[model samples]
Target chain A: MTLDVLAAGILSGGLYALIGLGISLVFGVLGLMNLAHGELVIAGAYLASLLVVDSGWDPLLALPLAMAGVALIAYPLQRYLLTPLLRGDKSAPLVGTFGLSLLAQALFQGVFGTHPKSLPASYADSGISVLGLRIQTIYLIAFALTTVLCAATHLVLTRTRAGSAVRAASADPATAAVLGINVSTVYAMTFAGAAALAAAGGVLTGVAQSFTPTSGLPLLLTGMAVMALAGIGSVGGVLLAGIALGVLQSASVQLFGGGMRDVVVYLAFFLVLAVRPQGLFRKAATG
Target chain B: MIRSTSRRIHALGAAALLAATAGCAGNASSSSGGKNDDGGPIVIGTSISLSGTTVLNQIRDGYLLAVQKVNAEGGLEVGGKKRKVELKVLDNRSDTNTMVQQVRSLALTDHVVGLLGSCCQQNIDMQGQADALKVPLVMGALPVELLPKGKGYTWDSFQSLADGAKDFYTVAAGAKTDKKTLIVTNNDAQGISTGKLWGATGKKAGFTIAATKAVPTGTTDFSDVIKAGKSSHAQVLIAAMAPPDCFAMWKQMKALAYKPKVAVGVQCAQTPGWGSLGKLGDGTLVQLNWSDTAGLPETNLIVSKYGKKYTNLTDLGSVALGLHEATILLDAIKSAGSTDADAINKALAKSTTVSAQGPVKFVDNKSVTPTFIGQWEGGAIKQVWPAKGGSPLASLTGLG
Candidate 1:
């Protein structure tokens, strides 16, 4: 299709990757599919709105604080509530996270009366021309921010000592614990870190589009799709998969029609899962 | 072999996770539908979208206001006896399936005499439930033209899309534009019908249809649609999608510099949240079912009661709709003089009740309300068309 359309897809994929990164990180580390990840993302948006909408602070100014705020809230949730469930039956954490998602949705509704909200910015509805292609200014900022966050996430996971501890816990929690690694702490940290990423994505999303209490479901599904396409443990793969899903969606809209966009994306997601259960990007099982 | 089995288990677990999350996402639940004992208060039930993405609190308030007024007058006279009305409202959270189930339950289980409608597509879905159970359902907020042909159980009293489109084009005719229009709507039934009806009406009004695209409900990307609009150099834009879709598309349209001289976001830009877009939201046009300047019945009362709660004309219109719908149903019950479903249905067919939105008479299961074209200006919707009891139109500054 057109260069502008392709560029839009790629940029949109950056936000998708940011959303997927959290789900991937959580599933890889805790082996607990956190259903509340989308809520975490939306929680970030609402949190930023407090500063942006109420106090008239810029959305970018509120981004880090929102990230830290959601991460702080998520830390205790994983450590106290979800981590304990992980020690129990396999289905417990899944059900527990689902329940948390419901609880979060209710809390959001209770707090922020069921109206759609957005973070207003000068660039929120502006455009920029890159060479010959026109791009949405918000999407351009979101893409750059997503890329930096994704790269930072990769570096943190691959280069740091905390990353090694995360890998250790992810590989074998029992052995890692025996070797003096605090598996529970690492699990909580990873979940918190993933939540931070989701919050960042949420802030950008709030800047990009309007969101409501129930906006998390579609985002959660998209994040889940990204995780599925990227496989369990690869951060870089999540980025690529997000972009691929974005391009596929754009291409599908071009070829089929806008009505078949989700259908085509989900069909491709299903086919990819059926063919490569591990994922398209993951080379092998980490353990 | 162990690894392969483990892989299968993981896949199955992932599948189950997706299924469970999907199942729980809607958060669909219903409040208890109290028993409707013989000679008890007339139980009128409604499955409304009180919460979720599309909240209709203003309409709900209208329903409550009409019921309160009737109750204040010592209730409706039914079967030679005055009985207080008990409105059983269940929040459907804007889910169609939930709305259908709740409406069915309200009819069969709760055994309500009549039903009140939710907004938009939910109301359309509720029509089927009302028909199957043969419960007389009255609703507003949904355009009259989009009401699907049903078994006469559902009655829609709202603004007609054709009338609104005609009024909009009439307004557009005076504007400086190329007469080329680009239409985009969500691919849902209502959205599709909206696109067709608006397209037909625009063409009739001498506007050329540049392109009409139908995207899904949650679609965030509009590059394809924007490209089409730009390529066609369409000066008039009509989008009938959800609030979120409109928000994104409006932002993207402004960003990509696809400036339509006159943009009317029907169904989408009507939401109160549209104001949140700030300056970017100004100059967009939306159709209104009621305008204060129209001198509708109960205007003073509506303002006295809800003027503080709902300041915008759009919300006031919704409240008037709720009041209009409920008043008609209660009047039908009074005319029938009994709680009998068939009698109420027959009475509703011949209903002529006047409330906040003026006189409403159902002809072919539809009542045409006065349609006014409103423009978003300084975060409030002001009537900008009709040249009578309306302000002068403003240039679209939102895109620039």
Candidate 2:
């Protein structure tokens, strides 16, 4: 395969990593499989489309506002809706998120219409060449941005006091609650934090490619595969798994063909799960 | 033993997940109820997709438009009595199983005289429903070649893929490009037919097929196809797929810096959504099954009535197809003088009527409509072929 093909895969993996980052965090810390994760991502893109397409603003500048908008919506949703359900059955949150996904699809259709919309940027169609290796300009930007976000997220979970509380709550919710930590509030914040990451990924996706209201489901599947590979709770592992998927996808397309992409990637995923259920990048421990 | 069972279980779960998500990813639904406004006695029912990946708003509007005009003329005169027509419509929400159930309920419970077909693969699936229930269904939008052979109940009167391929190849023959071509199509029945017929016809029209890639529906990746196009330096590109697929592929092709001298999008580029791709979607040629300037007998009414919603001729093409299908079925019902399935089926086989797409003659339960070549320009498509009433062909711009 050509260097360009491999380069494209690794670069696009940045967005995939960002998508999986939120999913992994929520699954690991909050223990909620957010099926509505993809909707948050698309919501960010649709909100930004108003600025990019209607207001004629630069997409890079609009990206933060989109993330913030989705995060704001996500915070209230977790606080008012999902947090109550979490107090009872674990399956309640999963079903609620699925319903949220359907509701989001309906809302997007009602507001934005079913037509495919793309956030156009100057660098969206062009690429830069470095030492005879050409890479897509958007993917290159997305990769750098993904690295920054990954580091920032890692710092929040390690250095910050809130991160300590989240770790405590995640380890033992009842004990953490007895120690004066509002475990439910931390859970809501964790969900919001993950949602913001999904929004960032969504904005990047919008600038890179076209999106419809229905685009979220395939993206959700991709994120699920990454989370499965990364084995929840590893921020860095999410990045690695995302890049691995991108490379595998690129290699398969360059080797077998585009039609065999799912077959090849899914088989590799199954193999990875079978061989190492704890994930390829996670630490193994025995009690 | 546990590991082996878990592996088997994982494989089964993965297979089921892929099966569920395959081919039908677009899940947005829009609903529109039908009107039996005239309070007519004859009830014609349809369970077409109102929302989802394959939205048929235009088709639904076309059905209503035809029904409205027919009802205005005191409905169909059946057995020397004027019976007003009432259409019982249900939204299938773009699910094939829902469509099957709704069609059955419409035919057996509601007792409608006939059924109208949905677009693309849904129409193919509905054929079995029509045959099994012994109800006559007139379908459009899907190319005739992709449909099954005449089975007495289903009548297809749409563009012939073979005829469209010849027209597109003849149009491309005049373009300034290398003779090498690349074919990228969806791996569905229609997509396969389009690639095969277009490649075979293109070769006869002096073009060589350099590479061919058949991808699954809902595929957003085009790197493999672009790699082939780049290596072969294929100057002619033919893409036959859905709008979403074309939108994704066109962006990827541009991002990869692979530009064909002449690119034609069959079945995918005709949607009004193609304009949303902006400059990247420009210069793509689309083979149209119907055109406003084709000078058909019903063009005046189609434009004048549906002009507000469908100002662009390209958007009106499929609507005209739906309008003609309903009109043809209505005429067949008029000739039958009864709503009997056997009578309507026989009448439809020999039905001869004119539509917005021009002379509708059901030869072997299939009719060939006039195919027009259109080019994307200025947020709309203009007729670029036939060299008579069509505008002069323009050089393709927007390579990047």
Candidate 3:
């Protein structure tokens, strides 16, 4: 009955979709799950917090700074540490990413000490009446921004020259190279875009909840779940899965006791996977 | 004459053996360091979370401040030996494994005479190490059940509160009404223990069983729990989760526009740490044992002096608890006449402390201290229960 709750749920789902997009994109391009997605998200969040809370910069302004920070770290990390493993075996990159995730978790814990610090802003508390329901101003802003970012991402992946190169590389890298595409650049760009999306998600997260170094684990797990539920490499599927997961979560908490909420949602996920192994929204090919 | 000679020779041989045994015991005690008649500096190691979880920081700051204050006044006097009491702090990072490892390192590497530990009951199993080494450990804020039931370990571990579960139940029993209470707990040891206490108290307090819920820590969606409550027409909601989870849940309650008769529980009303929630925390009631009004004069003095050092809050209880740790250890060192582990532990077992939390005399349970209850009213923490010595109790309003 509460419209605000529905709005909030939808907005929350959007954020989840953003996170899922990153996971799916990584899997689509690299054919591997970047287990460190959560850490990257955390890195982005902390970077944003440092800028806004410590340096006294505007939170929105800190977004790109955080994205750039993640890219810088991710680039070198991928080049030096992750690349060597990629050449060896398929599971090698996956295992290395896991190690990197652990290392990132430890590093953040060592530095931040686990107490959650929030980005300073009045907008977090500011709200207005919309349709006689209480709607937080930040949630509205986050939703609009997330939507715009998702639209722009879809455009970049489907419409432009770089987008074509990235798609070709994902589909058939050898064919893309034969067709005169710099497959390496496309791979790097895809990873960078995934990192940037994670950063954007992190910025929204900073507004949504108080987070610490340990906050990354749940995020990474959730991201992976969304990607798996949606079928990795399906952008539209990720979006649908994110919303479905959120609604399922809301419904779970509503009907069943909280003890069974997670069990039920996970059960639904398993059932869906069993019924439609390619996911409910999975397409044979992108037109 | 022959019998007397024989007895004297036997007595001489027995005396020799007794002296040898005493030598071994003394050597064992002095293995860390020789017991100087003029007490040098006595170093006590603490493996507590100095940073993780703001509550732990509040405790650490309070503990350090007390140590500093005591040292400034003068060193501890034990058996006519003057020793400067020094607290060696190790950041346990809120991990039990880390705490255990830190304790071992502090004892073996740093050669500390005594060890102080985290307030978490789950980690109190480390007392086995203290027992094995014949040392004293002053554990802060563990539930009484963590210790063996109907038994006491006088040599190894000492607790501040004996009946913490009783305190929680007492608060719940006194607060509950005829409402169908919904109990939500985190999936952790403390959370589970809290749920059990609240469940027992809810029934005693005249609350009907609506639904008992458990959420994994860091749960974001509380809708399912809320929906279950909504369907059951739950009049009261009791959550045994942390502040952040509680904050999110309260916000969701607002978002759902679901206002029951009242929502109350351990984390929502009891914690002073959830101040970040602002208005979302209003009408939430939590029960705690420490308050400035009920605190000793020394606690207020300590807070006034050292309050400016941290950006975060330093609660009256945390400071008092920290002071309690220091005073209790100091008492043990004095009573034992030596900083030897076994001797100091013996002293700790019998010691009584007049701390900021008031008189904390340890009996069997380690979780029950001179207790009280507090509520967050209009963004300020106020003492609410145990009206014998504190301010007038505030009535439950708004949601109730």
TM-score of only chain B in every candidate structure:
0.86, 0.86, 0.78
Off by over 4 Å in 1: A284-287, B1-40, B52-54, B79-81, B95-111, B132-134
lDDT of 2 by residue, A65-94 (tens): 888888889988888677776665557678
Model 3: how far is A133 from its true place, Å? 11
| Local accuracy of candidate 2 as per-residue lDDT tens digits, B193-281 | 66888889988888999999998776766777887899999998999887778877787777778889888888678777677667877
Per-model TM-score, in order, reads: 0.91, 0.91, 0.78
Per-residue lDDT over A102-186 for candidate 3, one digit per residue giving the tens place of the 0 to 100 score: 6676677667655554554556545567777665555666767767776777788889988888889889988999999877666
True contacts kept of 3: 0.11
TM-score of 3: 0.78
Tell me which of candidates 1 and 2 scores higher on DockQ: 1
**What value of lDDT does candidate 1 attain over all alpha carbons?**
0.87
Give per-residue CA lDDT, model 3, range B1-400, as digits (tens).
Answer: 3444345445545755775465335323112442233356787767776533322656666667667766787877766756677777766555677777777877787678886656764346657666655556776665445565422332213222324334434544554445677888997766776677777766775667688778877787666666667778876777777656776666555555556655565644445435545555555666664666653557557657656643222255666666666677777787787867767766766776566555555665353455555565665666655665445444445333
RMSD for each of the candidates: 5.2, 6.5, 13.3
Stretches of candidate 2 above 4 Å error?
A284-287, B1-40, B188-190
Best by lDDT: 1
Candidate closest to the true structure, highest DockQ: 1
Write the residue-wise lDDT of candidate 1 on B1-400 in tens digits: 3454345446546766885575445333333445544766888988888765667778888888988999999998986789888888777877788888888888888899999998877888888888899899998877787788999999998887778989999998888999999999999876887889999998889999999999999999998999899999999999998889999999999998899999998877877878889999999998878888777799888888999998878888888888989999999999999889999999988887877777878888999888889999888998887678799999899985
Tell me the lDDT of candidate 3: 0.65
